[model samples]
Target: MAEEQMNFQAEVSRLLDIVAHSLYSEKEIFLRELISNAADACDRLRHAALTQGGLLGDDSSFRIRLKADPSARTLTIADNGIGMNREELIDNLGTIARSGTAAFVQQLENKAEGANLIGQFGVGFYSAFMVAEKVEVATRRAGEDRGWLWSSDGRGAFTVAEDADAPARGTRIVLHLRQGEEEYLDAQRIRQIVHTYSDHIAVPVVLESKKEDEPDETLNAASALWTRPKSEITDEQYKEFYHHVGHAFDDPWLRLHFKAEGVMEYTGLLFVPSQKPFDLFHPDRKPGVRLYVKRVFITDDCAELLPPYLRFLRGIVDTEDLPLNVSRELLQNNPRLAKIRQALVKKVLGELKQKAEAAPEEYANFWETFGPVLKEGLYEDGQQRDTLLALARFRSTTREGWVSLADYVKDMKPGQEAIYTITGDDPKALAKSPQLEGFAAKGIEVLLLSDPVDDFWLSMVPAYDGKPFKSVTRGGADLDSIGGGDKKDTAEAEQQDEAAPGIDALIAFVKLTLKDQVKDVRVSKRLTSSPVCLVADEGDLDMHLERMLKAQHQLDRSSQRILEVNPGHAMVKALAAQVGKDGAGGVVEDAAWLLLDQARIIEGEPLPDAVAFSQRLSKLVEKGLLAG
Candidate 1:
């Protein structure tokens, strides 16, 4: 067939430009990425061979070969694994075909910290362009007869043509070194890069010999890092292994390596990354931890091996108990697998607790990245809710940074019965919520929950340490039992309360005026700065939850919310006096609707009737102008 030329996918083209031009600080990273991809291809072949006969044929052994040629100005990385066919080459190399490609591109484009992003999105092939003026990939897929050659110059276009002499059953990538990239041509430099970054890769990485009499040299340990004893492994080895297994560039925040015996025998090498992966929250994202049985590759995407909440964790879990040919269907209901998962969860939570106590600052950073993900356990895994709750950290109205539930309970105001919280889309906005004013004034702290998962878990975890989780925007705040602030502020509040003699009459008239618009209109014990605020009725869903459901189209309509008026506010007092004198006339009626809309706006709820709100607001402003 004639050579076919094609323009790179738009996203891939843009990515190649950024990777080729700007990511020079860590140019050596391209070697690690290419080596990692080579190792993964071998693993895929190993796994595929388990089911298919003769897939490995004569070459049952797997290895990655590196050849650096100074005279030719070329470096080749070859892998004896599952090589790509023509379609696979174009789909995998010529395009960013994954679900989060746009997001991945944006992340790399925006942050220099995205150096680790290369291998993560399966776009690491393009990283070869970082040092190479041109790249050529020659491959023959395992169990296939045809071979293909793909070449690119990192400008805009690439060509794929049939190769008459490609490798029998693997891929070979040749990088034509750029003018000043002679460093990559040095065998010693390639050896050092392999030792630093690809040493933990399970596949043997052999450096091809340049001299006719010299033997090829193995550059890596060629043994699985997880299978080795923790005492024998160095921290650098573990980090490099994480880079290999996790397809990650960032250092691990924490690593857990342990072997369990007795009922079930298994070894787990788990890592929590310092930076969250771009697809951490993608609904279709699979667990990063690969599962192996008795040191043989099984599958990388076994959701049953770990709970979805812990999906951020990356590494491997190898078990001696599971059969080597275990299928995905059996994994779901396997009792032994269930026990292993439970033990794994307990171990991880225990380690996290120790870290939280020993080095709180470091643990706080981990929480900021993975806390929302971990909170999913509260709703899904009731068995480990207690441990997850203990490890959870939250921002609160009275605390800077994150506060634990234990800390929140310890600092509760005198006579405060429940653990107060307010839920919203933003933490800063939740802190300024009018529903929190009275609680804040009384020195009571309210947990400010902003994550969407917060609402789901709060429902499952009704109470903690014997105190119920109470939303400040739900029911009566009951802050009256909690003592007020300093004597001066208390006295001033009392004076304003006494000045508003028409408050009771105003509440009655406003309630009648907005009968259909609100569930109830009552003088609030929770309001101080704002004239009015909205809250969920005692029996209704929390305001935030209801709004969230409506937004998702799960709920057809929202339950009517209660409007709480601050009796001490000057505007409320004036409106109250007018209601008493005018007897719920047009002006007071307009004020009632306008105040309701203002409270809705403050709560971040969309006004039910925006046109009516605008008309009412304009009329109120015009009336004041005319009366003046």
Candidate 2:
């Protein structure tokens, strides 16, 4: 067949340009990426061979072969696995056919530094360009006769042509080294790189002898890292294995390795990443833990193996009890797998509990990254709700860092009966909420929840310990009963109430004027600084929940909220006096609406009628200025 040349995809061209110009700090990663791809191809063939006969052909032993030719300035990585045909070559190599390609490109364009784009985007094949001036891939897919050659110069174009002399049953990638990249061609350096990055790979990585007199060397252990004893593994080995299995750049914050020797036996080697995965919140993202039955590859994604809340975990679960040919559907209904999942959850949660107790500061950092994800269990996994709640942490009105439910309970005021919380889109803004002012003044801490998941889980988890969770933005705070208040402040508030004799009449007048827009208008015990604030009625939805539902289009309209006026504020006192004299008409009517709109704006709610609000504000401002 004739050679066909094609321009790279726009994203791929951008990627190649960055990569060829040394996008990565560590050039040795080129070998790691190639080896990982080679190992994946081998694993695929091994799995396919179970159903299809003769896929492996004569090369039943799957291995990755590496040859370095210093004389020719080339290093070759070859694998006898599931190599690609012409179309597969083009589709896989010429495009970034993955979700979040646009996001990846945007981040790159924004100069995001030290990113593992190759691993994160499934474009590891292109990393070869980091160290090579040119690359050539020659391969024949397993169980197919035709072969193809793919050539690229890392200059935005690649060519694919028929290769009569391609490998019989796999791929062989040759990297023509650029000047100063001679380290990759050294046997010792090649061995060191493989030991550092690809040692955990299950496939054997063979390094060809530099001289005719020596035998070819297998640089890796050629066995699954999880199968080895935990005592035999070092921390560096664990980290390298995590990078290989997780396809992640960050180190593992926590590593769990254990063997379940009970009725349904399995071995699990899981790592909790220090950094969140790029697709952790993607709707289609599933757990990346590979499942192997008796060391035979089954599938990389088995959602049934772990609860979705623990989806951030990355590694492998190899079971002796499950069938090697088990399909995904079968895995879902498998009782033994369910048992394994339950046990794994318990084990992980227990380890986390220990870690939280031993090293709280470190665990707090982990919680910052994965706490929102772990909170999903409170809503979805009923059996583990208590454990998840204990593991939870939050920012609070009184504290600078994360506080646990246990710590909050311990620090509760003498007469406090509930776990107070306030939900919003931002913790910093929530801290400044007028509704929290009275609580803050009384030294009562309220939990500040910022994650969207906080809303869902708060509904499922009604309380922590024996204290019911009460939103500060709800009508009934009963702040009078909570002890710990400045006696002088109480006396001053009482004095203000006496002096502002029109406050009750003003509340009644405002209530009648804005009856259609508000559930009720009343004086607030929760307001100390702001003139007014909004809160949900006792039986209505929480203000934050209502706003969130409306924003998501899940709810057509928000529940009416109570408008609470601060009796001590100068503006409120003056408005009350005006209402007392004018009796609920003209200027008082506009003031009533303005106060409601001001409260809404502070609460992050949009005005119902912006034009009317503007007109009323201008009229009021003009009247006040002329009087002054």
User: lDDT for every model?
Assistant: 0.88, 0.87
Write the residue-wise lDDT of candidate 2 on 1-628 in tens digits: 9999999999889888777777777889889988988998898889888878989766699899999998999999999989999999999999887778877876655435535545765677888998899999999998898999999998989999999999998899999999999998989999899999888889999998878999999999989999998888889989988888888778899999999896888999999999888778888769878888899888888889888899999999999998776776888878999899899999999999999999999999999999999988998999999998999999998989999999999999989999999999999999998998788777899999999888888888878788999888886669778888677766655564564768888899899989888888888888777889999987788888888898889999768788989999878887877875643367888989999999999998889899999998888788782143
Name the candidate that leads on TM-score.
Answer: 1
Backbone clashes for every candidate come to 0, 0
Query: Residue by residue across 54-134, what tens digits does model 1's lDDT show?
Result: 999888999999998888999999999999999999998888777878878887786465576766665777889889989
TM agreement with the true structure for every prediction: 0.96, 0.95
- The reply for model 2, stretches above 4 Å from the true place, is 108-112, 115-118, 210-213, 496-499, 580-584, 625-628
What pairs collide in candidate 2?
none
RMSD of each: 1.9, 2.1
Quote model 2's TM-score. 0.95
